[model samples]
Target: MPLSTRQSVIIALIVASAYFMENLDATVIATALPHMAATFGVTPVGLSIGMTAYLLAIAVFIPISGWVADRFGQRSVFGGAIVVFTGASVLCGLSNGLVEFTVARILQGVGGAMMVPVGRLAVLRSTEKHHLMRSIAYITWPGLAAPVVGPALGGFISTYFSWRWIFLLNVPIGLLGLALTATFIPNYRASTHRPFDVSGFVLSGVALICLMYGMELVGQLHSDWRITVAALTCGAGAAALAIRHLGRAAHPLIDLSPWRIPTFRVTLDGGSLYVVSVSVSPFLLPLLFQLGFGLNSFAAGLLVLAYAAGNLGMKSVTTPILKRFGYRNVMIVNGLLTAATIAMCSLISPSTPRVLITLVLLIGGLCRSMQFTGINTLAFADVPPARMSSASTFFSMVQQMTIGLGIAFGAIALHAAVLVHGNHAQLSLADFRVAFLLVAVLVLISVLYFIGIEPDAGREVSGHTRTASR
Candidate 1:
């Protein structure tokens, strides 16, 4: 039976609500970090544990979401995730100590890990191919709004109300999401059953955890040789184990064979690096404004609002650019633009006009939006529907892991510069300028990955006709 328009809208709203909560939870903590640190009697580095715990939990559980959805049913899984996430938010708000907060965040991450991809999958399963783009556009709107609103909302609540309010706000939103999901989302189960790959799952989880932890540790240790060596060793060993396990397994949790496809491989590599570049800015920008520029929490939050505004404004232009230039051209050019904007951020100084800084952030946000849309769309453009599940899981995992690593890297860089300058107590504005420049250079290196893309790789995405003779 054909569904009514209202039913479709309701389903989309349910999914978007879940996505908004997930994205908001990811960034809302940024503005609250200092307050969280003071309350827990920890340093900036210590507060990172909160972010790390959530990220690590998401990384570990992402692969299992698909399996669970297939086993139980999408509607059940989706509804249950909302419950877990909302309950965890309550726990997070109620926690007093760092350990308790971290634990609650882990639970939140588990729920979050399930929420997004599963919700998206639900939308896709319900919508026809012709309407897929519109459905995706609708789902993406909340995600765009989350980052824009997260900083200001977090700052306002943490400053006047308390950091706990940030988490508490999710209660009402989650409840609404739950009700919608139960009412609108259809139950879905896989027809062809594949045995659960227990061994593969364990190895992949171990590998991801080790890699993320190592990258995070590298950021924390900076120039500390011993710590860097230890982290690298563990990370390398875990990666090797995962590779070997996947090669032999009948049904690996994550099939690395996708990497053999040149297009998929190039896209994933570039996407991972692109994510790393974009992810670091949000984490570092708040600290730069509040600590270095001497802005109050609310003012710093407002600056972040500029970045989000740019992101929102750029979305309308993204598809047209991709259509005109094609994916390879779009990615290559936008990647360079993103790198240039990031480099421009390094030029910020205490005496720099607020208008100039805002412009830089705005341009950076626009370029980043283009970069993200291009990368995400191109990553799956060539993927056949049968492999969509694995591809989705792989893409989601890389994106989340890179985001965590990027933030960790930014923090480490800032801390190292401060330590080297022998000014830990007073991190000067100049120090932050140097850190932004360093990250910009790192972002520049990511452009090379986009350069390797095949010119013809994304033709279908741009609506160009393929010549049968070719």
Candidate 2:
């Protein structure tokens, strides 16, 4: 029997909460870094290991998440992951040394790698086609809001309380997530499981690890460019090998068949490119405000609140908008608007009115919310039920990679601007202008991919009525 509407909504919310917890944890640590370094008796730069460790862990483990869930059961793996993550959070809070903290973060990543993809798989298996958009909307906001909100929230908690509270805060949320997962989540497994693809796993894992580590290197303000290039090159080579191997393997670690589906292919290609462009904002905005606009970190963080408001503002109306406009029209139009807003950031100067900046961010947030929800929901609109596991896993992996790429893209753009102008010790307003324009261009490139989408594609889920051709 299909899950009732009420049950479906409940499961979606529970999964959303778990996603929120994971995202918040990932970003919340930034503001608390200084305090953490003080406690650990190390430089702030040294603590980057903790952040990189978590990311690398997630990248290495995500490819196998689907296989593990199928080998076990979704509910069993999901609940166990929660336990592991929660326990690791406690360990993070208690750590007095960098090694201990980094290890704890890796453990947390392992749990998170399994938690989200499997939970999403369960949701897709249970939700009716009509409900997919709303279900995706429910889950999308937390990921969007967490990055915007995390810095301010972390600053507040770190200033008034101990930095340890940052990790410890996850305790209650994780505990509640555990209860919900065990009670409501179904234990799904493959009826006929394939043997593990050990070779495929090795190739994919190396590719992701190198790619992520390379991006991490690029994002750092002071890193060896030589090492970054080498890491990225190795990642690309390994990725090519992984793709070739998966195509030939009898029981591939990740099923590449989803790429043959038009809707799913669009999401993997166009949607990922869009993500790379959009991801640049979070990395760039704070630097723009602090370095370019002469604003304090607090004021800069406050400005992002407008963006977050726009995200929440659109949440209630996304379903209606999609139903009215359909995915193809909505994504192409909204994506352009999103790029326009991003480009507008280049116009902000010290003298630019804060209100105008706020308005721009608000509009950008709205467009981002709609475009992301549409792309995500539509990816699965045409996927078969049996392929949900592999589809979700592949999508999750791409999402993670693109996010890392976004940050790297922003950092590299800023670096290039610096080189183009006379090399300076500190970045200037003109540097930001160049960077924003470049990021905007990245977004525009994605539109070419979006243009390939079929006119009536994803109409089934969006509920958009197609008019007959005259």
Best-matching candidate per TM-score: 2
Local distance difference test values of all predictions, in order: 0.76, 0.89
CA RMSD per model (angstroms): 3.7, 1.4
- What TM-score number comes out for model 2? 0.98
Give the lDDT of residue 101 in candidate 1: 92
| Cα error of candidate 2 at position 453, Å | 1.2
User: Cα miss at 354, model 2 (Å)?
Assistant: 1.5
The superposed Cα distance between candidate 1 and the true structure at residue 187, in angstroms, equals: 2.8
Q: Across residues 195-307, which tens digit of lDDT does each residue of candidate 2 receive? A: 99999999999999999999989988788989999999999999999999999999999999998999999988999999998888888898899888888777888998888
How many angstroms is residue 321 displaced in model 1 relative to the true structure, after the best TM-score fit?
A: 2.3
Local accuracy of candidate 1 as per-residue lDDT tens digits, 1-470: 22455676678778888888999997788778888888888886778788888877887899877777777888999899999999999999998888999999999999998887778767656754434433555566565567667877877788898998899999999998888788888888777767888886786787777777777776663447676667667767877887798788887777666677676787688778777767788777877888878888778878877888887788677655655566677778778888888887777877899899899889888887667666655665666665666666777777777777787778777877887788867768767777777787777777888888876675665443234212
User: In terms of lDDT, which candidate is strongest?
Assistant: 2
lDDT of 1: 0.76
